[model samples]
Target chain A: MPDLLPENTPFAIARYTPDELKAALRKMYLIRKFEEGAEESYTRGLIHGTMHLSIGQEASAVGACMALGDADKITSTHRGHGHCVAKGADVSRMFAEFFGKESGYCRGRGGSMHIADVEKGNLGANGIVGGGLPIAVGAALSAKRLGTGAVTVCFFGDGANNEGAFHEALNMAAIWKLPVVFVCENNKYGMSTSTERSTAVRRIATRADAYAMPGVTVDGNDFSAVSEAMDAAVARARAGEGPSLVESMTYRWRGHSKSDRNRYRSKEEIADWMARDPITRMADMLVEHGIATREEIAGLEAGADREIAEAIEFAKTGENPKVAEVTRDVYTEAVQ
Target chain B: MNMDAGTLARPEQETRELSYAEAIREAMDIALAADERVVLMGEDIGVYGGAFQVTGDLVHKYGTDRVIDTPISELGGAGVAVGAAMTGLRPIFEFQFSDFATLAMEQIVNQAAKVRYMLGGAVSVPVVMRMPAGSGTGAAAQHSQSLEAWFAHVPGLKVVQPSTPEDAKGLLLAALEDPDPVLIFEHKLLYKMKGEVPAGHYLTPIGKAAIRRKGTDLTIVATSIMVHKALEAAQTLAGEGIEAEVVDLRTIRPIDRETVLGSVRKTSRLLCVYEGVKTLGIGAEISAMVAESDAFDYLDAPIVRLGGAECPIPYNPDLERAAVPQVPDILQAARALAGERV
Candidate 1:
């Protein structure tokens, strides 16, 4: 219950215990394996719609959510499987949702783009760009008004920084002193347009200055850097100080979606980002810190692989939603 | 005090005359007093007393915490209200003008309207949005259009147009009690209209029609401010030996089919009147409903629709009056449907 680290602890892994470090490494593996399995399912024709995979940006998701608890909430982006898993969602239910099954989190209504677990504090994965920004502020407002002492983390892509919603949400959050942290996953590109071509600013974090909030940019591939920044941001929000913006500089190795032709970027760029895989970095860090052996890290990855395999089985065997019950979830009251 | 042998007992319920705006403010006061979860959020709704002065003085009583004054950000404010509603707070969001909803349609249509269904009913967005609509105040095209038809087309949204002070209070209270997102389209011109509204708590059920007048020659179905116009037209028709029935459709989305159909069946004619544009508007849906139902067999004349003109609401008073269907337009349409000279 006391402080996890001493007063001057600067690094995240230095603050975390051996077991905590290992668990974090396992989550990063779980996120990587889940997306890989999803891609495989798509290739096998088991999945119908295209998905936005956060293949190489696992550390940003895991690290940003490292300080949050089950009570804390997160509003995620379209590429949100990492955030969902990082926030303690069951992968089987997630896979069930992706497969459009009744046992899924959204009862087959919401697919990959809208997966949500309210009980787990995953507000939802929004399909629209910058859609979750204002919603996160509202959630924070609810927390403040209800005296719940809960902090909300809003995850958006760099493209969202240009959206009107981003500015409005940030301004409102700052003015009302809402308990929220705006985490921008700067994945270099919004579909095909790179941040250089789309965004007006050199860095998205600097835009937070206009809203009068402290902003920080960190190496999103480095788990310790992201975790340290997020921990401080979340602490500020929970203390009723106000919202802060944390820009996670990362990249997606795969195409934006299944329909992406991969014509916008070169093969060299893809290989470059893949080489700095967040999962591999986290694994190596755990090993170097003496928290786990190489064999131990391999076992953790193997465990994630097994879990993903079982999740696919669960999703494949899940029951399809009935046609007669299609409109059942449209309203809390029965359809007139 | 002993009563005389032939004296009647006094009624327990109390009623008072209140303008449409006052009725709405009273409803908000009641909602805030009855439940701490209720909060009002809008631009200048606090000290400025709202652009239309509907939420006047309540902010003074309830404080800024309850009656919130949001910035001039419709899309973000609407989304925040939806999020708050989903997370246990009852937020009544007021749009400065109904035309401004275009900016916030992404949140209203995609996020608020579809969230519950998309999330498999895991959460309910019980947000109430108040939009001052219709083109009477000379607010021009940007500030004055009646855009309720667009919201009515959305499935998960409940759209209502309260024509009187009574329904304004009752229906607003009812909307707050609803578990789904409800949009109340208050015509700007009707804010000053007064009517006897019941004191204390009451509800005018959504998805029901109010038959303001009964006639046999033809049925004139109207919404929002047009309901008053239809009533005036019906009165003028009576003096001309043409009996026209007036039906006030309070709720547009889940339309009161039975009431409309029953009136049409008796009158054997139909005339749809609304301030929204004629093409692809609320009247189009009503006409289609009557034609597809068994009431089609009872129709003695072809259905007529009196709606706004093709162009935007003009700036000139005359053009503005001509743009939307006025009382004379409704009267002429009704007389024609009744096989009389316009």
Candidate 2:
């Protein structure tokens, strides 16, 4: 499995098969490539509404999600393509969604930010800062009450950490010992202000001390490290130890969205993070470890390309919702 | 959606009295005991016995699963309740206060209220969000607001406000059976006033208004705390040979226009009172209804509206009282309308 657990780190890697590692790597690459494609399409006006790409922080989303069982629920942020893909949501429907088609998750009413599939336990991508926090907590509450043991993972940005709901939810989760994990993809900026300038807490995880839960800071750039941390968090939650927070130190390779001029950060800073690119690093490790050949990796890349193209095509032929569809699913109505 | 006025006046209590708080507790106990699906979730509901103590000993009696306590996040608690309701389980959520409901409005108004219509009738959000609404506890502006009018503006929501203990239990039980999202705004002051309430499963159909007292001198339509104020005003006016019939519009949305209009026609004088602000309040709608109805021909006086003053609910006790109509405000307004005080 590409020596996923270095002789250095403290977490589980014993059960991971080589194939599982390759598959997870492939999925991360696919999400990155698809999102980049979508961003490009957005500039060309092929996609409508806002696009919050998870290009720079793919590892955090991927690693945490990989640790999740299919039955586990995930609440995602506005930049949720990674969460959706990792949860096994249909890529075709997602693409159709960005294309504003009725065949999409929310029938095009929600567009990119509001896409959701409850069956997959992907509880919508929220537009509000820290908005998805409570929903994930709710899902976790539901799981705990129903005795499902299904964990609920909430993905949010460092920005959400400052919101009142963040503290409120964290406190409650800790008090009740709900099965939830709070993942902060600390890509350093809340829109424009850097996390350092905005937050007083040195480490976001340190704030977990207040909640009496294990607080962690993981190498979010390294998929193995992230996966390890997430595995532990998810395990603790499933065991009913209560909620935990993992502050993933990562950077968004892209601007917050497709419209950035990159002014908030310098080119050198970007170049430094680029050196630790998650996809490239994982790919190189796969070959060095002989887990997969260069050609096999090439084939995987080729497959991702074809899949993304087919998704675009699927979206192109799809239709927007019948105007009446807008009023559906927000609440359930009896059809008697 | 309209209740028969004759049916709603089925005697508040033939034998006893109950406080508004006790009435709600009775309702909660009845609901929790009667149906397996009915559960309450909110902050302080468990070990603390609820923030307002409405759920006294519920957690001890029912255990943590049914009378679940939540974190201080209203949005999360409300969202969980909504999610549970979407599944087969029915959930009743308690807001520590009505003012804090704004934090969860995205879930309550956008998600809970509209889920039914948004899903094209595929799902039903039979969630009941109960908030202790209006001012009385000296909680100030942040803690008090009568927002029934806002939910009333929404199409799918069924808004219920009960002034008496009997209606409190009946309406809540009825709200549980309803297929759509129903908001029951229990007033802060009515929690202690006692009255005879039937035991066991019963219902007060949503979207129906109740006529508390009958008179021909004037028709006083009111809600929540204002309903009691209107009744008191009616009694004082009765001694002065100015009879004021009191109508409690229990359900704000889908209001019982027939009951309201019938009294307006008989009295030929209409006065609407609400705990909400005067500007764009429920009184406006009731006044508009009277204006649009055939009862306009029976009007002997211009329709009068009495509501909270156009200002934030002040923190100072006296100022807060001045902001919203008090019992004395109702009496003075009724006397003016009846041409008795002047």
Candidate 3:
């Protein structure tokens, strides 16, 4: 095996082997490629409705989810494509959902923001801010009640920390000692407002102290750092020690939505963040460790590109739901 | 005593009389005993036996794990209940007062109500929220408001107002068995009222209205505590030449439109009485349903609604009586709609 990167700190040892690192690299590449393709689809007037992209925050999504098992559950937010992809959702169905195809995860009813794969243990992505916090708590409660050894990971944005649901959910989980990990992806801005302008606390994880749970803030762009923090949190939950708050400090590369004109932040900020692209960093790490050569990294990118291209094709060719069935699924039962 | 003449046939199965509160408690007891997945979560529900004492002695029987007492955060408890329901736990969440549901509107409306539909029906939320509704005993504005109309307006949620003791038991049991979210609005005044309730597990089918008394001249549709008032008014109206039919709308949504339209067709006149506000109440929905249906042409007079006045439920007994409809208010409204002089 190639020389392992020297351990920089007590918790900084590379957790993943060469093969796992390659898989992690592939997953991140898949998320970025999928989101880029979706943006292209939206610009071309093919995809309808608005979508929140996790374009710059792939490490936070993939790293945290990588620490979870298949039996574990997660509740995601509006900008949840990366979380869903990281949690093992099929890209074809995810893209099909965005395209309003009947073959989509929600059968074309829930668009990008509401994509869910129940079989994959994703409860569902929520449109409302802080909506998934309580849901994750509930899943944890279920695991505890049933004596199931599974844990739950709740993914929300920096804005969700200010929501009442966030406070209530965390407190309940803490009091009950439910097996849940509250993962806050603190992307600098909640829409146009900066985190500093809206939030009263210096770090979002500090709020976890009020709930009496361990709190940690990690470099969200660094997958290894996020993975380490998430592993600790997950272990605490699985061990019945109660919930912990993991605030992944990150930034969003694109505008909040399709209507954004980049008016809130300077191009300098964008350029600066782009230079720290998570995918590039992972590729460099892989090369430095002799996990793969530069050619192998390019091949992985090509593979992800092909996968996204196929997903778009599948979405374009898939059938749209019948207009007659528009009123169906409103309720579990058909009411006259 | 006058309501005895209009009482529906009770089930023959070993039946015993129970107060409305006892009936509801028994329903939860049966549910918890039968299903291991069923849990009761609310404020002061464990040791305090719920704010209304509806969950008395349950915490001791099931232990703290099954009967959970939550913090004062309605939003948090409600969200946790919704989440628990989503993950296969049949949770019965009790709101100390119906008015306090305003604090949990996000979880109830945005989360619980929309989750199934928004997720394309992949999963169902089998959550039951019990709200002690209506006024009496002078709980005042903050505690006395009847907010069933708010929940009935939501699409995915099933809303039921159980006026009788038997219904209080049966409806709650049925709500637990339902595959979706259900809101049970139990009138505070009806808690002490006694009626025959069945012994074992039973179900009062939701979405079906009960015709308490059969009449011809006019129809009085009511809900919650107002159902009792309408029944009393029906007795008084019978003493007069005019006969008033009483229809207890148990389920507000999936609102037995057929039964309502059928009653309207027979009576040729309609008066909706509720404890909620007069404007945009369940009465308005009933009136609209009649006007929009084939019963519109059968109306002998314009529809009238006897609901709470456009004011908060005052703390004073006299003013509180004036704020919401009582037996006298129902009688007066029935007399006017029956084309009788005051």
Predicted model with the maximum TM-score: 3
lDDT of 1 by residue, B1-342 (tens): 011110113224498889999999999999999998899999999999999899999999999988999999999999999888888899999998988889999999999999999998899999999999999888788988989999988889999999888889989999999999999999999999887788988888888888888779998899988888888878788999998778889999789899999999999999999999999998899899999999999998889998999999999999999999998888777877899423
DockQ, per-model, please?
0.81, 0.24, 0.78
Residue pairs with colliding backbones in model 3 are: none
Q: What tens-digit string does per-residue lDDT give for candidate 1 at A1-336?
A: 126545554476676778888898899999999999999999999989889999999999999988999999999999999999999999999999999999999999999999899998999999999999989999998898888999999999998999999999999999999999999999999999999999888999999999999999999998989999999999999999999999999999889999999899999998898898888888877776667999999999999999999999999999999999988877789757
Candidate 3 versus the native: TM-score?
Answer: 0.97
Best lDDT among the predictions, by candidate number:
1
Which residue runs does candidate 1 get wrong by more than 4 Å?
A: A1-10, B1-12, B340-342
* Model 2 DockQ (Cα-based): 0.24
Any runs in candidate 3 off by more than 4 Å, and if so which?
Answer: A1-6, A9-13, B2-9, B340-342
lDDT of each: 0.90, 0.80, 0.89
Quality of candidate 1 docking, DockQ = 0.81
Error of 2 at A230 (Å): 1.5
Distance (Å) between predicted and true CA of A209, model 1? 0.5
- Count of clashing pairs, candidate 1: 0
lDDT value, candidate 2, whole model: 0.80
